[model samples]
Target: MIIRELITHRWGNKELVTSPSFGTVEKVFVKDDMRVLEWEPLFIIRTENGSLEQIAVGVNGVINSVHVKEGDHVIPGMVMAFIKDDLLDSDIS
Candidate 1:
């Protein structure tokens, strides 16, 4: 199944933009050339209200897209990054 889809708005025409997970961005753990497992902690976003939230990988895949950098503010529904799931069946030869 293709899991990579551009995040859009409810109107279908507007592009969905992501902001700090909570209210403020604190740190980013994953970077280029890093291998991560499913449900791994990727980053942390601190909210303006003084709450820290941990962002993790939802699936088993490689980090493909990262829209925000350290100290960048983000919101909900934002496309943090794209993960390409590894195919075990295809690898079997």
Candidate 2:
């Protein structure tokens, strides 16, 4: 996938919002280097008033790495993980 399109919404498209803002890591549902599907929850974040929000993987890819664990603080635009496209020929069929 185009990394530029993944980061910048230049085409009215969707990409993983890696960092919405500094928030506490509430839970992690995915593991490192694992295959994930689009719209799958990768992490749950405790952002406002102890409320939990899920961070989803916007595309199908392998979890290259995880940067934070539960209770860790995150930053804006920080690459929590890296994902490479798992495009199969049949995906378009």
Candidate 3:
């Protein structure tokens, strides 16, 4: 029998890549449809303290979309992009 979990628990496929800090986006390393590895540097942010912080893609996936551009001000938990996890697709497909 196939056991399925709740929608909130099954966050495998399309996932939102959110910002962990309040800052201005200094740079974006990948564009839409770019494949990325887990922990790969995806964005650089200039924090309110004026320090540069590198944000990494936490999942190995193809970037489905990018919401923020360089110079965009972002707050913590802001959705920066949507990524479709490669491993997640394997299970669904």
Candidate 4:
């Protein structure tokens, strides 16, 4: 029998982000339709003082879409992109 167990991620397919501090979107290392591994840095945020912070993908998945780019403004709790995992199983909780 063919079996397909769907495992959904905690944040779903959407990758949302919230800037820890007031910063400008600096660089984006990912784009639409890109695949990423868990804990991979997706982008960087730079503050006025030239310090940078990296945003990472918490799960392994494909990038479905990108909502922001370099030089974009980052807001608290904003959706950055959508991601779809490659594997699924009933063990998802």
- Output the lDDT of residue 82, model 2: 60
Candidate 1 — what's its lDDT?
Answer: 0.56
RMSD of each: 8.3, 7.4, 9.0, 9.9
Which candidate comes out best when scored by TM-score?
Answer: 3
What TM-score would each prediction reach against the true structure?
0.66, 0.69, 0.81, 0.70
For residue 63, model 1's alpha carbon misses the true position, in angstroms, by 0.9
Q: Count clashing residue pairs per candidate.
A: 10, 0, 0, 1
The C-alpha lDDT values of all candidates are: 0.56, 0.62, 0.76, 0.66
Question: Across residues 1-93, which tens digit of lDDT does each residue of candidate 2 receive?
Answer: 111113412112322337565678877877777888877777777764666677775578666667778888887676566665565313676
Task: Sort by TM-score, best first.
Answer: 3, 4, 2, 1
For candidate 2, list the clashing residue pairs, or say none.
none
Model 4 vs. true fold: TM: 0.70
Which residue segments of model 3 deviate by more than 4 Å?
1-12, 91-93
The ten-residue window of minimal lDDT in model 1 covers: 1-10
| Model 2: lowest-lDDT 10 consecutive positions | 1-10
- 1-93 per-residue lDDT for model 4 (tens digits): 111122223465454444554668888888989888877777787866667777775567778778888998876556666776655422657
Residue 38 error, candidate 1, Å = 1.2
Better of 1 and 4 by lDDT: 4
lDDT of 1 at 14: 21
User: Candidate 1 — which pairs collide?
Assistant: 18-75, 18-78, 19-74, 19-75, 20-74, 20-75, 23-47, 24-46, 65-81, 65-82
Candidate with the larger lDDT of 3 and 4: 3
